[model samples]
Target chain A: MRALVLLRAFSRAKAHTLLFSSHCARRHCHAPAKRERAKGPRILGPDLPDIWRSPPLDSTHPPPPLIDANQEINPTIIDGNSIAEEIRSRTAEEVHQMKDAVKKIPGLAVILVGQRRDSQTYVRYKIKACHEVGIRSLTAELPEDCTEDEVVDSVSRFNEDPSVHGILVQLPLPQHMNEERILGAISLEKDVDGFHPLNVGNLAMRGREPLFIPCAARACIELLTRTGIELMGKHVAVIGRSKVVGLPTTLLLQRHHATVSSVHAFTKNPQDITRQADIVISAAGVANLVRGSWLKRGAVVIDVGTNPVEDPSSEHGYHLTGDVCFKEAVKVASAITPVPGGVGPVTIAMLLSNTLDSAKQIYGLNC
Target chain B: MRALVLLRAFSRAKAHTLLFSSHCARRHCHAPAKRERAKGPRILGPDLPDIWRSPPLDSTHPPPPLIDANQEINPTIIDGNSIAEEIRSRTAEEVHQMKDAVKKIPGLAVILVGQRRDSQTYVRYKIKACHEVGIRSLTAELPEDCTEDEVVDSVSRFNEDPSVHGILVQLPLPQHMNEERILGAISLEKDVDGFHPLNVGNLAMRGREPLFIPCAARACIELLTRTGIELMGKHVAVIGRSKVVGLPTTLLLQRHHATVSSVHAFTKNPQDITRQADIVISAAGVANLVRGSWLKRGAVVIDVGTNPVEDPSSEHGYHLTGDVCFKEAVKVASAITPVPGGVGPVTIAMLLSNTLDSAKQIYGLNC
Candidate 1:
């Protein structure tokens, strides 16, 4: 069924392109001014072809104008890499000023267990990010066979260390290890990942603010607001209900006064319901689960899905894909975030920001 | 605007009844079965007249058959009084059994300030309830001019008291006092109202269960589930997003796998959004805010609003009204809960149950 959906999405893209080209030929043939113009047609709705498609331009059909073309025909590409860099740079500046005043830098400790290559890569990136922003990095690597007690012991060491302002446990610990026990061992004040129950509770309640928000969920909303999408009174359909992402995102959205709907795996006619949203955020981790047909014509889409689909052409033999069918959706949606470059980069930036905030709080430095 | 909405609701109800009576005279003039029948027409759509009208039972047509009358007309009234009584009885039975096994009954502590008449009445009712259920009640009455420290000190005394299993501070603390500080002073173990941050956090996250949920929120879900309204895969619209009721209710409903929409004060065209819901739970605190026209035909409504509107005819000079315009809603909804008897009774029953559970946990008795 997954393969069928993928094939169908690709086929829809092809079908739309063919229909667009034929219609363009007939329309341009009748209007000489349109052929002469440098800019593309005003493609504001579902009639527009996917932005990823490169249509040939020659003297007869004269290439659609390059200037102002994107503004007219293309979906807004939310640039997470630049946004992440901006945040990181601001954090680094803050760190520089704090260290100069206090003679101490913020510190973050990470606990990792088992030797998953992906986990190691993520840890390396986090540590590197910390260093880039002038924060101290403390690492404790435990063996896969280590008991839950050993994991908790490592976390407790960091909890007692006054230098460590934040503690993060790389998730998906060894199968036998109890995750709750290990995560709970971290002190709530230094839980920069915002997975602690108290932080989550604060996030869920009104008039109570959580010290930190789960970075990924915060990044999603940050991207939207940074790009100037209005959230108030708008209907947002959240396509997942996971504690870390979906549920918290729903809470945050509702807090922002958006009429929010939470649609999960058990929801009936999920497509029909999701299509009513002015903004659709899919965090279900299901690759290409949301198709072009599942969205409203001008909906804003934030895809938090980072599932790996087998891709033989890639050097790694796999490629990251989002919950949305990008090729098909770009034509339908008004704005969209690409999979790997979108929420992932912003998420790391948010984590760094959180760590810095925690340190500032400890040092009594207002930011 | 509030008065306009209320007036419109009453006018709509009157119009529907007049239209129905006139239509009945014309349609049932020839049908003898119609005049003999106790049941009204099967009104199942937006255009149907309100079902509450009782036209004269003259011999225009003979009385219709009496069998299966309910199958055709009259919505199911969710008798909160009966349901609450049942829950209280069961709680009493559990309390009796626990005392039999461990010679100790559960205890509850309530702290009140400023002596609001309603608050005093509620507190008295709670103490009376505790006595009837074989539980002990402790009350601390503070003056309206009491300092914040005095309130905190009172909470501290109860927190240290081993006999007190649960602590509840009456809400709407004097404007000068900080509610969060006062509420936070309660020990997590004895925070039977479940207002503690950790408990709320557990409630928000999956795989983690809070020791208790705020009673009113739980009562709303209990009423629904006990009445056999399936929450899973259903659309539940929660009006209002207050921390005590609306927000927690939304969280609980989403956790139960329902597609939940949170409509708050900032929501635009709330009636339009509410009409799409299969179940509507209103806690907005505005009397007669939700009109029959705002609901979908056959929708189930759980009203948690308790507001007093001036009524010259009433002995108290005012009468309690729910957020829903109940008189108009009864004709439109499939099932509805009355204001005074609905969530109010269930809420108190839930409090008693929570106190008992706290005692059970403390005694290491598995229930």
Candidate 2:
């Protein structure tokens, strides 16, 4: 990735934030708000009015769905936690059957470069998921000051081990290290994160499918398809253009024949674009970015944002929140995913699924 | 390409049409009219009005631009032939300077797998361009009955040739051959066509640039940028989704921060969507598919289609036409690209530029 090249040019302080800030702060909170909100430059014409913006919803339209965040009878609240449990149960059964036939179970290796609290929590969740699915979990925890070569060496060890069917490098390696070099070092066959360029290329292309889709991206699409929501010809606006979630998810939606619009940090009037969408998937990781007014009537919303906001009243010092203003969006959306229990659960489930697939592929076993 | 894999599974007749029909018929002309006209499957909530369609140009709206299909006084006609000639001249000067410095010039090797007349014409044009630019052009002409292994072997020879800085394998190879295998065999370093997955991956990524972009796709963007057309925040509707042109172009546009909507064969009511776009680039190779009614009054239209339609008045039985109906669209669009003289000429020039770039990269010379 070009990020590797830029890292070498970045100042020590800049590189530190670039590499570790995502894990340390939990949100892309580095840039100045004014600078970030400048909006992308206009290229099509001399400043045109935003044609996508819809006027305020009037009573003539169907009344806004009831706004009751605590109510259970409004729109169908997608139960991602339950669906993930179902997936884990099925994966466990498959592991059991595979162990009986091949005398081996799937194994996952996660290489954590630093002791960032957030990264640690994610790594722990993945290991727990593997355990629940009856698969072996191995972790290589390196120090904060570890060399890039050292990180690669740890990955190489797992790549060489026949028992390790899947390898995941915990992201946001130390500022001093080259993230692309270490990630690229992972053998493609064992790359469960699907961050490898080859896998991404295959995903972007037609007539070619990625061997492994990024877990979070796959989970978002899985939620829609599993819910029997047809994707063909739908106008799905994706709010976020990050490599991990937004970009790949757009490609996946396109593969399903959905007309996708990617609204990123530079997008002008993102709400206007989201309102026209038949389905909205936001992964900007900005708390309460999407509000009730941004939704079209009966729009399906999938919130991939997991921003931690300060909450002194809660047991923890902070509480996780989604990009959408869930309290308000729930009243307007036909279906919506809740933070903490939404895409997170399904993402872990997908990691387990990918691991099982890798093991099956290695053994030439049919599912 | 997935088309290559599907070729293996297709009946011989289907495979023949799939691979050779583009060359034989000069466009995607085999499908039934009804099937081609049928709207894409519905995915967004039930049948809805064509929301994207704009009303006819009236007094309320600005009057249509001058009706000037035969005249050249309204929108600036992008003179591809002149621009390509300028590119060739500059490339020649670069080759001269490099030869003076290092006593060597760039060499390009082209592998022709079959005797398709259309394919031959394209190959000849490339060779002529190379000659004009003072680059050595090597041709390896294989028969129609050549095996897939033979094609790969030909590419391998070019890959090993230290003198060759660029390698191009003309598309629409013989029906019996595996297109992907042969294309993939070309060394990534000398992939002038830029179809390699690595190059595509780089193109799709943010903060990353491809070693080489597909020439035609590059030409399209080059025209926009060279003409001082701003791309940022523009709603660019791309009317094709082919790997060679549409898909890569969309990725390139996104890199420029454009809000892009990809309209493809599966897109329903494409006219509605096109009318809403500030800029439209169509590459479906469907003659006269875009009409005046489909365009915004001041939109910029780039037609990449070069479909050969029956023309009794011409010396040849057919003449080239574009996806946009020039007569109707020219009156509506602020700027428009003509069929044969637009993207086609720029494509040949881009190949020269790519070859020159390859030489610079290989020789460690700065431009």
Candidate 3:
């Protein structure tokens, strides 16, 4: 058991590609000969083995039961996308069942600073989702030049306002504003992003859940479990160690009884280690990073990356792809979440779920 | 990896014990019969394996470098008795450090609801420890019939008082009063006991530290580290999964990178796992549960149990013996902490440290 960990001690995350049979990829593209292999710092270059070498082409062990690019059998696809649809319909029904007809609505205040396009899209979608769910969403788009006091003032207003059940500041606030301070200012009850270290810490510990669930982290688990994937007694491999993904995912999985090994950018020979997993979740942004060759047969893959790759055929000048190299993986894997459908929709579903939770908490109502 | 994790699914809090011949218990006690061996539950039992059952018990697979418990050495014979006196002198110097002369002495408001004799003793020691640390210690003892609101009122008063930087309400409040209500009311910033779910959650997370440290938890780490015991890359087996001890202790050690395992009452074979550890920290209230036969050669054992065992020979009529069978474990363990002196003094020391940290946070000085 210890021998495998030691063997990978000097290995690093590699860009894996599958030598797809002629039936796949359709052309003699001969996927870019795996390049940019990570290697330890050495005075002399190209010292020994290639750093960017593609993962082994040899199929060694019996393949894991997984959902790769080829295996498009995500449970949600067959269930009529019913889980999310139920949530949306429930939100509609509940909103219609309000107390006053013009009752103290679920109030969510979002603070956005600067013009980061991604943050803007997230905020926009959140507000739209809130409105769709009959939540009164308030947007506070402050200028990049705004001071820390300005952000704190906005948070203070939401904290006192009985109308507001949640306060979420769009992340990546201007450099001048202390993210911790701005988040902390949002009273614990109203801090809906749950990015407050206290919230994050609370989420990690036993005996309690977060006041406002971090949607992305929760979504990763939801996608995995809803597909008849039980967490207990499973060997799961998670890539990425960001506070948002890798670390939180590990804590959540442990809570559910999965013996997990974490691999990040600093991990050695991550592919070989990952190949041993019953489930693989990649949140790292490296594009087409996970190829069929890297996966254990039938291993479930949930790609959280939303990287955009250049594709002239798309009107946007580029196309969004997942961390997985889909075509080759589909032939060997069992189940896989598509880039745009699997986790993305679940993220929104959880956000709505958390907002509903926030409303229930504030109103002393049971859900 | 999958099979071991499943067939040997174990908690990571306190794991890895007795893997060598040194684990043999002393002549002072009888070993548990082969038929009565301690085994963790088949599923999530205590994380430690009975290391004594493993092979190559010597230099080939040594005890963790940080611990190096000389199972053959008697701590009393090795000057461990002087640790208390040495601690006393060091604590005295800290009080006289002169940095707090002009400071508004940080105060801890300790509230006791019921008159349990043991509770009284614990509180008294804590108050005295605070005094020795040059901090103001306020005592508020309420009647057993006190209402929940009354308890909350005292906590509110302490929270409002600028002088109080820490608050601890003695445990086992009367059954009539809601413990959660009283605990939740103590300001999170001054919760020194760290029983509040918020505090517990914070400490459970990786890359997160509680604002006000948990005393016993911190003490375990401090005591081990002060004695030159490092946890990095070692495996620690923790017995007990109580909120106060087993669970938090596991989280604390994991943060230190000691592959930890947790064991609770439901564990099928507890000692079988403990035998594999480089270190064993047992907080289970069970008496003499861990014995020499279950230990690996030279394993360090930190017995956190303060269980009062009947002993007519002692002045108190009841004497404290650790969860471990001390007499037998003493012969096998490289270093073993005594029941009364080992953990007790350090727990007080850490409480003082937390009070000091609370003061720094409150005053924003010398942090």
Candidate 4:
């Protein structure tokens, strides 16, 4: 399984190289103009690849240009999509083995309350990933006006189900509902989201192992580790302290022996702090929050922000953007993760991986 | 109760001023000679007050000089003993009121499993503080070679005891014992030490409050807040990542909206990071780990280290030292806490506070 994953990763890297060559071909046409702009303060928006952009039909904003045309330096793009794919493939193989050995497959149960488009899309992606890995997926779709007890009932039912190895309650339950109370109802063993206080506490302490880590935080570390970015003894500036990502990422980074500086809204002169870091992880959910000046030269950038910016050209009428000013950061940073294909896909892969681990624990099987 | 505590604090502050004046008179005797040493790198040992030092009976190390001879600045000496006394007085008044309003009092049960001198001293202090605050105290002294189940049995008994509002398992439990398993057995409600993962997890997350925060971390925050030092938006360098003090202190600082940089042994240039902070909290346990150059002038210093250094003149054959080089820091920092008299006393006070809060919660009392 390890060899298979490595083989997939190697092929993916080669594919990434070929794709970059095509981007280089497109960049040559505007190389002269780009070099002039690169001399001054970079005011350019993210130069996304054509493949990542949609057709301009009744578009409000003009389509962003292709890759930065700077010939002097091209950063090694940390391909999170490729890494997530490798993880999913490994999880699939393990699920297949587990099923053959015990005639038992991993099961994930999701309770998504309300009809929030973003939440629905997230749940759909999760279910699809579960099915791809041969994991049984169960979902309870509650009305927008559902009571707190209704959500608890779904969680309780899933907790009692022997077949359900993982339970996730999609976040941002209606403002009227008590999110913490509902989440607290989930059984510790089946909390694949790893939102339980016990799990989080375990993660924070040294010599203690959390049963599961939150998917996005796990994704951040996985991307760095798999990409051979050394964390130990390195200075990391984690921007934002949201419970789901920033806070957990800080705890996990400390566990890995990285000296972390947590930057938030209350931070004064955040740029100076970020510039001092060996690595900068921006999860602030603010568009273009981290500019070129905010990072040190050769710093590794992990963009976890998935802010939605209006784009009528896209089918969803919006495009996902990252916290980093991509065009500006790519010039200063040695390596960087792109918005839509970066931490987002890897986060989903982590969810599947966690679900498989949960099932394996219950079945007493080791992959 | 509040007024009484304030009055006691005012008296204590006045007494501290009187004590410092006599030290100033002593400093005048060696003013000319000490002035020469201050111009250099300031390689002086802690200038402890005569009251804090024991008589030099079989003295090996020379008696250290008095406060820094530099007359240009005199930092506010954050007398934690005075602050802790204020808290204890408040708790005592509240406990007294509780006894009047109801016939019950807060109870704290401590389980000491080993003969480690430090643990024993800490447990003794806790018991003494509880008694001083009018809270009931119980203790179980187990042998060093006691079985894990034996310790758990004690915890279980306390967990079920209606009179026991708080349970504390004195740390560094024998090498053979599984500490996490034993601590996990304690009832969450009675976990006054707040070592439980749930409490830690809650503390790490925004919009969530832990039932109890670790005592030393609480002491760090209380010392700062009571001193009128604003935390919101301030840059704080937390040296060390120990679960008991450093890690929790970092989390709590973040919750208070402070941008915190966690510097550990792995950090390449901890001094540079510490120098950049408005506040520096040293809990690294290394004696004088933070030097004068590591601090910014006018920065607030909270030294939580209580490291024991050999001192033949002292009765105990050792003396408590802080992580900061006091004589050096005193010249630079705007405010600083001393070693033995600083965080140590307040930690015990917080444990008492937590026990009182736990009992109040259980009894459904507002106070």
Candidate 5:
């Protein structure tokens, strides 16, 4: 087992080096080719290299190389982890400055109800993240069968607490509890999750600004903008219509002056629509739902889906996967974000950013 | 001049008759033809009819007929005026019931600033509409140079007036006035225009309901549903992103399970996108921006634009026209709404409907 782990790590490192070198070469030698190729059919031809046409590998085997040596094109890998770290470091600096100037730091209060292991793990990550940025954190844990009033009371306490600059009620609250009622109890000023209808409405409207934007949606845009992708006048196809990610992302894209098309389960010929977009964002939550054939050549792909599929070789007997088949997309896209290290890290960074913003507003510090 | 007036009126009546008879015949004879043609290219062939090929007419000439004798297809004209009358009559009956049961009728307060002739005309029409439906109306006329505080005070007064179930602040308030601040001051319950961020947010979210939907957006949906058009899974292209019509309409279409593409000023190749939609809704506020070639052969068209263009032959020296070229679209679309009598009338009726609903909610009468 130890030898196998070493082999897998070595293979991954080798794959990264190959992809990076190829990506660099393509940028220098094929800039004009990329644009000309984008106008033609993106369907892979039968002459695909043996390595590119290989079938999916099992967890027992070492992961295949991300780029085939003989392949003519390879996408630029968007390193979300590095970007997230950059944001966190910047936020930490701000927090340190606030502490030095005013002897205060941002505070985030999280209310977690029920014992779902996933929810507990998520809360733990959030708390740890707060500590990393020098922000104070508090948690309210309730029994699985807690009453709606109990949850509301916890929110009320946080709402009234001046130290709690941001209040987040962990989602999927016990089935018996009314999610809307409890969420609505959070003060609008401290709604760091940006789930409040007023915040959403303001975000959707032109010339209006929301106090806070939803984290995942903000993460998607941050990834693109940070990568120097200009959104203005660009055509974007967002696959999914969930309130948490897809809907807000579409609205945000429109705010950036991108022509947006929302494709969901009911959409007929979704691939055809997606193939025409210059940017494709998939939040459908269906593992490997989007294929290379669904994308336009040289398109920028942002996969927000994070589904856990069973994998016995893993410690937890499962592994996280995204909506797109990464193997197929990397060959066709101009730039692509990988699953585990992509949107998830950036989303957490946005949460920290929002909390910091709330603290600044409360403390009357423009910075 | 009198003879020309009679000639124009007679010509219009004859055109309506021709369109109606042809539409009915095509519905019976070309039901299958419509479905088959939808898959083929929609461009007009070289053998186009002479009447359809005529250039734009001057005000002096009699308006051209809507259908040619040899034309193979004619769309079913959506009669917005008649549909609006039906809704208005229904609202009047509900108002009568409320008066009989509780001795109360819905009251609307309009705050009009400045002396813009168009704004004054719109306010006059609204007041007349309220009276037609047995709604009590009040107006506060302010000068063009009124202070922001004066506008806020007007909104505050209406907000406090329990008798006023709905409050409408006429749009395009003086350049010096802040529109957002004044509109935000209106009580949420009395925001009949549904411009409140909270209402818009709720409308955009799944499993959430807004206190009121914007009138024009609601009107667009009413026209489609009442005309027996199925929105579920349909591909809809919404041209424009205005807060009043386009934005809300696009949001509403998503709520109805339609896959929506928002085609805006920044959209590349807007015609290509519009041509692929199963339903095309133009609210760009640009007169005659959409031509016949921009439509699918059997697509449903909802023209929400109401742009006023100079017409010396008219009493007002200007006539209201929609974003679509009516003469060209009639031959391509499966169903269409005409300008002047299309979404304009229906939008006002929706306002009345929203006001009536507000009164019912406040009066504790669900019916």
Candidate 6:
């Protein structure tokens, strides 16, 4: 068990605030610009080759030029995709280090039902991202005819499995199936999705803290925090108050000292109120719903909507667009998250981050 | 059961909104004021109660001169004893009716530990108020040696008993107990205190309604609202963020369209931020804490603190004071709640209100 002492170093990355210090087995790291790491072979995402096979640099097939931390995160320049890739690479390094030390790999199970093409594609993207973060990926593609009992059984299996730290049952699970019941059934401990009532309650309250990692909401705040944006005393407008995204997102934003207004469909003259917001986050899933003038000038925009609209030019006959009218919004808003490239990648990164949290909690690192 | 119901109705001089609307064996359709209730019982608070509780005035206690509908709600002077009496009278008719129908009567359990003279006095006053409201009061005077588990187990037993709807385990439960654990252990369905996470979450989230009810925080807002002071679009400064009162209170104000800034001990320059607010509620439990100069002129203040100050002038050797410097604030501030008299009585009224909620939930009125 003394070998476990070596495993503790990778966990210390969270505490490395001022110094980029880490005790890696190998002189390698996996972020955008890999930094000094603990002693171990470098790990890659599921899509990438093992550390032994892949060379340090792919001079022939070069990856996209990484964005400098100093530069503003650009949406049009595959920002979401890139941020996600960077996160996965970092996770890969940690996973690889653990594997090198003879530890069972951390895993995430994604249970998808029915063929909403967008949802299916999302699962695929998540699977690819999971490997990048060094967390083993398990995908159970259930058919549209699947029973509630079957889904329940699978979640139970994942719950019992020591290897799996997170189990995500993709949203919009067929209308006939009870969504709340299914969501509530997920054990609070393993609910990395952070949609459980206890987690939401903890997030809403002052002293109580959620044990489950709030992936999407946390990602939005983390992106802003990492970007050095000061949130204290900022008035943030969160449009669309869904249980999954908008509501919890508002709570998290409020936690960081941002005065938040959650506007739902019923809110009269929502745009008039939105214009007052210093920060606009539209997770309504309505394509181009947030108009140009609806935004407050210089406001930071985070578009969580992944609504696919019909586009003749696209191969799939549809193009994914966010709730915000990006073209016009970008002109006025100081910064905004892109449709495909913004919040999407950050969600996966946070998921992996949560899995590691579960690993840490299981191992009793700090507690 | 039918005989008991009739007895309960007979006990009260007249029935109020909730009981009259829900449990009344027969409708008072002939009455003019009652005729307007074609939509059945108005579940909304205060407005319905004002219309329903019309007593035939005697020479001694004549209906205080006919005032307009929009006048302030302090029927009695700002003194705590007078306000507590006035509130009791408002619910007098309903109290009579409740006693008529159910011989067992509405009950509230007040659990107290040790002789924290202040807490003991508070509990004693609450028990006295219950009797005034025609409610059966139950007190569990536990020894200072009572373990956390013992307290929790007692609360659990009371929660299972159908008779006890509102259970208040007095705050500052002896040092040995974990407060959050004990509070969390109280069933949300029976939690009239509204300290349960579910209620807090519901209160914080936009559009979602809480089942148990919010009391102390709601009472603070109700005081301001009753005084014809609208919180909508007003900047409210909450100078605390405790789970019980401050945090939930701020969120409730925010939900009502008040731009709220919650400050605490961690907050630097709290008065600077509070000065910008139109309404100030200091629940930090610090006596004479909020100086007059810190307040914005014409700011409506609701002092939710029940801090005890050493005052040898009184027989008890201590006097209950508020978070505000009342003498200083009264000159600058347009309206302020006096420490001992203001929020204390309203808290009991809200407890009664929550019992009605518990009964309503059990009755499935909302569902």
The numbered model that scores best in TM-score is: 5
Which scores greater on DockQ, model 3 or model 5? 5
Q: What does the TM-score come to for chain B in model 5?
A: 0.80
DockQ of each: 0.19, 0.12, 0.04, 0.20, 0.19, 0.08
Q: Write the per-residue lDDT of candidate 4 for residues A147-186, one digit (tens) a residue.
A: 9799999998997888998999998777666666677777
- In candidate 5, position B128 carries an lDDT of 94
lDDT of every predicted structure (CA atoms): 0.73, 0.71, 0.60, 0.76, 0.75, 0.62
Residue A161, candidate 2: Cα error in Å is 1.7
Model 5 chain B — which ten-residue stretch has the worst lDDT? B30-39
Worst 10 residues of 4 chain B by lDDT: B28-37
Q: Which model, 2 or 4, shows the larger TM-score? A: 4
B314-364: candidate 1 lDDT, tens digit per residue:
998999999888999898788899989998898898889888877776665
- Candidate 5 - CAPRI tier? incorrect
- Per-residue C-alpha lDDT of model 6 across residues A1-367, encoded as one tens digit per residue: 2223223322332233113222221111111111112122111101110011111121222111223335553343226666666666777776776666557677888999999987888898888877666788887778888987788888878877778878889986875455544665665556788776556666776434565536778767765765556676666778766667876787777666665655655443456546666678888777787887776566778899898889999998999999888898876667778888888888878788677655544544322
* Candidate 2 chain A least-lDDT 10 residues: A30-39
Clashing pairs in 5: none
- Report the lDDT tens digits of candidate 3 across residue range A73-140: 43323131455565666765665655454466677888888898789988998888788878888888
How would you encode candidate 1's per-residue C-alpha lDDT over A91-148 as one tens digit per residue? Answer: 8998899889998888999999989978998899899989888889999999999987
List the TM-score for candidate 1's chain B.
Answer: 0.80
Residue pairs with clashing backbones, model 2: none
The digit string of per-residue lDDT tens for model 3 on B1-367 reads: 3224322322211121112122221111111111101111111112231111111111222233333443335443223335544555554554455255644666889999888988999999988877776778999999888787888999989887878878999876765655545776777667777766545544554423455446666667766765777676565778765556766677677656565545544333445446656789988777787877767777888888898878899888898877888888887777788878777777776666566656654544343
Count: clashes, candidate 2: 0
| Regions of candidate 1 where Cα sits further than 4 Å from its true position | A1-73, B1-73
